[model samples]
Target: MKNGAFGRDLLVKALYGSFKKLNPLDLWHNPVMFSVELGAIVLTVEFVLEALGYKKGVLWFTGWTTFWLWLTVLLSNFAESLSEIRGKARAESLKSYKTAVMAKKLREPLPDSPYDTVSSTDLRKGDLVLVEEGDIIPGDGEIVEGAALVNEAAVTGESAPVIREAGSDRNAVIGGTKVVAGRIVVKITANPGETFLDKMIGMIETAKRRKTPNERALEVLLVSLTAIFLVVVLNFRVLSEYLVRTTGRGEPASITILMALFVCLAPTTIAALLPAIGIAGMDRLFRRNVVALSGRAIEAAGDVNVLLLDKTGTITLGNRMASEFIPVGNHTFEECVHTAMIASIADETPEGKSIMELAKKTLGVRSDALPKNVKVIPFTPETKMSGVEVDGHSYRKGAFSAVKEYILRIGGTLPPELERVVGRIAMSGATPLVVVKDKEVVGVVALKDVLKEGIKARLAKLRNMGIKSIMITGDNPLTASAIAKEAGVDDFVAEAKPEDKLNLVRDLQKQGYIVAMTGDGTNDAPALAQADVAVAMNAGTQAAREAANLIDLDSDPSKLLDIVEVGKSMLITRGALTTFSIANDIAKYFVIVPSAVSPIFPHLDKLNILRLEDPYVAVLSAVIFNALIIPALTPLALKGAFYRAVAPDKLFVYNLLIYGVGGVIAPFVAIKLIYHLIEFFVG
Candidate 1:
């Protein structure tokens, strides 16, 4: 109940659901609980027989045993029901944001095309919708034309507006977010009920959630233990009859007592809370604004040994800004800044925008209006440069080699200090973009991309936990090495392409490494699919989201660290509770086994370390204790166990002393105290 707290209505619904789960058909999935229910029914019949004067034991004893047995099953049901109710409540809240809105449906993919106004719910895949400023996006889609500043607080919970533009990796947009500035034509990618929000809501609902691989395997172990314990308890009746004949003392174990012993010996504590633990793990991730398509992804995160991260937007601030304008030869700083700003007038990349901002702030230069006969050259992979031609002069800024070749071809000599200046910038982890006007070398703009704060510290923690961190980037070797050293990553791949990432993941997997890849682009889909744990950004392309199992709504690639912690916490909680549950039987055995046989073999009473005076009270007390512990530990199951970064060997020893030893001692004290209270009341 951290983010999705239970309200009065949710609590009432959960209470009702607990009773509804009492149906045998519903309990059938959990074999241990189902067997407990069967035992409760048998005890109820035995209590009625005692009341009708067929008396095999005291009527009050039989009645109390039956009541406790039923309560045990009910508490188990309530734990699971409460977890499911919280999940549904979160789903309802997500649904509230997806209200109907009118969309301007475009007949053609043109800015001024004929359009029809239709409800957002009627939107279909591949439909083009024209959205303007102040209009809410009708559905999840990619911007096909133009760009806008969108407020996506409805889904991401971040109030800052993000820029979504056509022909860029950041073009994807979710429905229910308003277009706060500019206009865009969006091409719908999902049908009305198949949007990202719809998929998230469906995945969180209890009925639709599939059991994770770990959950299924644990359930099998619990069922097998239940079967093994059932055989041991059933054999107790034969042993009791033999003892009665040999000593001519005591009665054969009654059905009520046999049922009580069987329930206590079985691993009921872990089984009762297993489903709740799995549901709570999903709820925790949802609270962090991450939606996991399957529980297996989260479980895999706990075991990941290698993390592959994209360099830009993940490790670094991503937007390279002009930090310095170093002039070459006799050119002044103002001349270099003016040339760079003029060359980037028709550019729209983040680096270009930053250059214009730097120029304006430094020298108050403005290029708001271009001359009527101006011609622009856009940057492309082949050209590696962008520039504009006006008044019979060409201004350009790009990679040093590209700009050098342009000036050389135009019959100009290179500046004497240009090479040294560029090398200094590259060595300092900044990209040096050469600026040239006509046939003369102007200067270089040092576009520096800074590392995200605390990234080095986070990677160091991952290293301590035995997870290797690798950075992948399209930058040259010099820049890549500088950033890798600055971020403290274990390894790096320079000048990497889409297939390079895919091949790296496959190679790491072949070496028996569990790789976790975080990416947010259409080019990242192949690698995301190949990695063991794939986390895609929600703002990424549809292909990336579809390929990855985990989607980060806030689009922060560093969130993978939090995901790993949550996964480890869930696994640790389940393992600790299981250790405690099995250890608990030690105390129950001392309370019930010795008391059951002590009537015929009085020497066996020495095993009753708590020194209970009444056999009937001892058995009843153990049954009540077993029932009460389910609700007592419900909060721990939902909240998860305490976790820290420690060696596996040390962790095992620590848990053994805490939960394992504590579990053995807690029941002895509780059962003895309960027996005394019951005896005083009966007397």
Candidate 2:
């Protein structure tokens, strides 16, 4: 019932728009419809003159024929107007997500800073705003400081509350979402009317999505067919006039009959509905919680051959945590864990926090250290070590080799037991970090990042689709290989640098593969830019988001599977309809052509195989069918034709026989049936 109302509203708009767009200059852009509009006008003039007795019975059916021609043009416009209405209505509802809110603009992005109240619309890019619990986030931005539990049901259509923290990949937040818990300072990324939802609304409302290469080629073919029909209509008229002049026929063919024949011959049925088909595809993607920058990207999703997946944060749960603490030397387990907990006290990473929690749970250790006078060295990707100094003693924890070398440099002897312990933990596919106090090796902390549930099944799905999933990580070869096998990916690149990932995309492209990459780090930005289809997580850095064409709002890399299916459906839908549309013209030709020319040459009546109706009725039936067919198939155009995951050659041949051959036969029965019904009603 709701769809019915929306359809009615669009028809009302098209009724008004039809008159507004009736001008010759405006109609010129649509050459196929412009021809029909011209024919309608010329025949209407002739019908008016004949009705005034200027000529007797010269255009007996011209008035009704002209009416049908005008209606035909209006139906085509109505199909487009109705297609846009679906997304337009959704856009209006999305505006509700942009609810009015007062933003507290910070003088600087920090707590306890001066702030001023302002409307969300007044917020500008790079401006910082403080959001408290239960307040709507003013605009699209990154959390510059603090953390919050955000309700994102309006955007991602999930009811779960997501944690957004500062200085992490998941820091970005959308406007109009509420901070259900905690507080955060956000630095706006987009101004008002420039948020992600706003961009999606604009793309859907405009409906001028960029066309893929195949769609462009199909358009050229349709236009060429229209041009050929234009010539056919003109020559048919010339022959009618020449025969009348030489043979002194009873009367020249009615201008209305010629107009009807032209409308039936052209492939205007598909042309009128093509834009609607593409718009429906985009709306489908948006409904699935994925935002595509353009229609071309969605089309590319259907053709992904090689999928390059990141290991951390993509295939596994990104929060790497400390699972077990093992004593390395002759030190007691509790003593080593107590010291490890103290060294990781100021650590903000998940690994650090989990270690503190574990120590408290097992040894009942209390955190009572002083906050001042502590020298700290943070971990860097290059150094791979972190340490703190209390008084004059240094406590450190890092990779086993880094700690072992530091202790050796301080004149400490190596322990044989430490090497065996490290090897056991490494073989288990967990990160082993050595905890040290001054020059003594104390213990090893096992950090494990668990793989997400059902990831192996997701990888298997991609493999069935002929997509090769390759895992790339900076982890050691053994760890990478173990994770690769566990995840069931086809290949793995161990200890791979950002440059290696970028080079892989280039090599894949050289081998004629459509390589698609998914990443969230700033280091992945360049490779994402070079990929055929780049999908950036919604929680990724701004650089990664800017570089990617598709943004996965759910942040599940496996969403790629759904995207590919939607894309294949879009392409298949268009192909199947185009086949049916052109083939439909063949049946209409047999219905109207013989009747059109039989009046000019009596012998041509034999070509009318069915011989079921008068020439006037047959022409009227065909014209009415042309106008009615647009609405008859409007649902199919918007919803798409039936699709299956079969090879293109198989799909083409299957559709050719079904839609192509069937389209030619079905319409003949319908047109004749319609004429017989009209004849009975008039009687």
Candidate 3:
């Protein structure tokens, strides 16, 4: 839909939601508004009776009062409906990228038969599909063959084209992203209507934003306060009669007095604005290009004590590449470089590809002369090594510890000189991929990955929020420490395997900490599930995405800091509004109760500190002012109260001074002005 049409639809739907709010049963979701709404209903009946000239005089005018009461309820509903309207417009935009198209499916691997053309929806999981340079990826899949530069702008909102190749970590591809160069054979990972983008769109359309724990707890407190006010109003008759006997004044029991007192003292403002606050928070997250599986997860992030970050793909650029070739143990640099190339000949990692290129440039090794039918050992998180075997001669290169153990297993130990060289390289903060041939150490390939720029400042923000950050890596301790110190993380864990990552999360939780893990590797799946707040990359594997509660579409790990702020924004917004709501009641009681009953008592007129022109106008003005404030604060509720990172007590003190004092002062002035306006017009 166009912008104008979307806005028009929003107002219409808001009107409909307002009508639905009139039902008393619907008040269960908004109990604080229930008493005022029911009062408006009763006043509307009196309006009809007074108009018919039945059993009443012009003692009270009910028309404008009734109109103000109901308008308050409708304004609250409209604020919430408008928030969802934004989400609907975004969902429609996502749908445009998924228009139907024909996909070329491969039935056989051999180049013997023509490919079959099938509907995009007909492509099932595990089916192989061929996408040309300009074609959109048929489904969410893993690249199993060929390479391509794919544009992920539709899904991630990034315009840069990323290279995708078979048999590597960056192979995952999303449907609806365009292929910009080369062709790729993708093995579908998701079936029809089950793609990642589909789940994202479904989330927005439903937008079932559940109440955060803080929201729920505050609601219970508000309900209790409402009940207490109800009891106080009920017994005010008995309390007033005692005074009536002594003073010879005070009016008899009246329903209008009870209704006005209940509406004024009860916490209605925040209650009416709670749903709007929550929906707006979700919409804000969506605008940041983050999709939260549940609003609860976003809230949980607010209290996260420990942030667990992966070192490779998250903290660094994640492009581990060969930077230098260092030979050890009396071998020429050329011999070591040639042996490193052989070990990485069949390896497909970016690290492996860089090793091959480095060898050709410096050592003049020819790729065409490399041996064929060689056995390739793929790197695994468990083994932490990759190797090649040609006729019983094993050439390996990987993590230093893994390669060291391999040399010992074959009765050939790493020479002291070679081991010292490995230590020197690792101490330099570069990953030392040790190269070995025939169980003897040959050289070390220094794989360098730079830390992301401006990461330290982001980590500092998390620290101010009372969150401790730790970096976990499979690199040696010296390298991990070097990186951690430069990055300014709170702590670092070196040589961490997949299981070690899971154990760290479990231990932290056992000690009363909320953990948040960010990773893109399948190995991080278990750790992600174990953490309190699991964030996955959009370019990550499907398994990793399934394990995570939030997805960063930009694939930027630094977005976690922003997510923390968003979560805290929700809690702080609700808290400030709640404080303001209750505090405003203090002023309302002064205006409403004295104006309602002081005519008979005359002595109770002392409480009319504002010295209003007329008595009935004071009471009506307080009620109208209270009703009008709901819509007045709607913008603040939707935008969320201004938040700053501080300790809990300090945060409370700050909000208390600002909202509490302001709430009390604002209502008194507004009600007094409204009373003057009523005198000017109606008198």
TM-score of each: 0.89, 0.78, 0.81
Best-matching candidate per TM-score: 1
lDDT of 2 by residue, 91-182 (tens): 77777797768999999757779999999999999999999999999899999899999998877878999999998878889898889999
Alpha-carbon shift of residue 505 in model 3 (angstroms) = 1.2
Which residue pairs of candidate 2 clash? none
TM-score of 2: 0.78
The C-alpha stretches of model 1 lying farther than 4 A from their native spots are: 1-8, 321-397, 406-417, 435-445, 679-683
Question: lDDT tens string, model 3, 554-590?
Answer: 8777787788888888888888998899889988988
* Sort order, lDDT high to low: 1, 3, 2
Candidate 3 regions exceeding 4 Å error are: 1-27, 57-60, 108-114, 237-250, 320-425, 431-449
* Residue range with the least summed lDDT across 10 consecutive positions in model 1: 364-373
lDDT of each: 0.89, 0.80, 0.82
